[model samples]
Target: MENDPQAQEEILEELVMALKAGGQSFILGILLTSILWGIATAQIWHYYRVYRDDSKSLKRFVFLLLLFNLAQFITIIYGAYYWLITCRLPGNYPKVLDVTK
Candidate 1:
């Protein structure tokens, strides 16, 4: 069957809208993940610098703390990706398009 030009145009518009929404959601997730990762890394680095020349026991504690922060950062990244995948699915047909033809 020959595809009607009007129907093709409507489908294209729907796809474009879905893609734009999904892209926006993905970008938001990336931004949030990056911020959290930066904060965690900075905190760990600060602690390490402060304890670099301290007693051996204190240095060990600082290392452990850094590891904990890294773990938390990983968890945050995983959650962000999960949310993006679930919320940004491209099947959301935009209501703005007039499909009543």
Candidate 2:
């Protein structure tokens, strides 16, 4: 079966479909995250501009929240890239659900 052209073609097509379906969700998530991040940035900017006399503690808290959001966004991008590009490489698939290792 290894040398059968038709079987190989079908297998290749299935693999392509699986990759497309999996990668599409990742792309959509990244896009949505980018939009939300932009909105958050704008809101934070407005907060600082409109409330210039806010307490230092409050400002620090808001800044920390923004940093955390940025971190989450960064991790999402890295995870998607790792799964879609790195794991999809030839021979990179994990064995029997041992993906975390």
Best by lDDT: 2
lDDT of 1 at 12: 63
Looking at model 2, the pairs that clash are none
Candidate 2: what lDDT? 0.80
Q: Would you list the C-alpha lDDT of every candidate in the order shown? A: 0.63, 0.80
TM-score of each: 0.45, 0.77
In model 1, the runs with Cα more than 4 Å from the true position are: 1-5, 53-101
lDDT of 2 by residue, 28-74 (tens): 99999999999999999999999999999999999999999999999
Clashes of each: 0, 0
Off by over 4 Å in 2: 1-14, 93-101
Cα RMSD (Å) between model 1 and the true structure? Answer: 7.1
Looking at model 2, which ten-residue stretch has the lowest summed lDDT? 92-101
State in Å the error of residue 23, model 2: 1.1
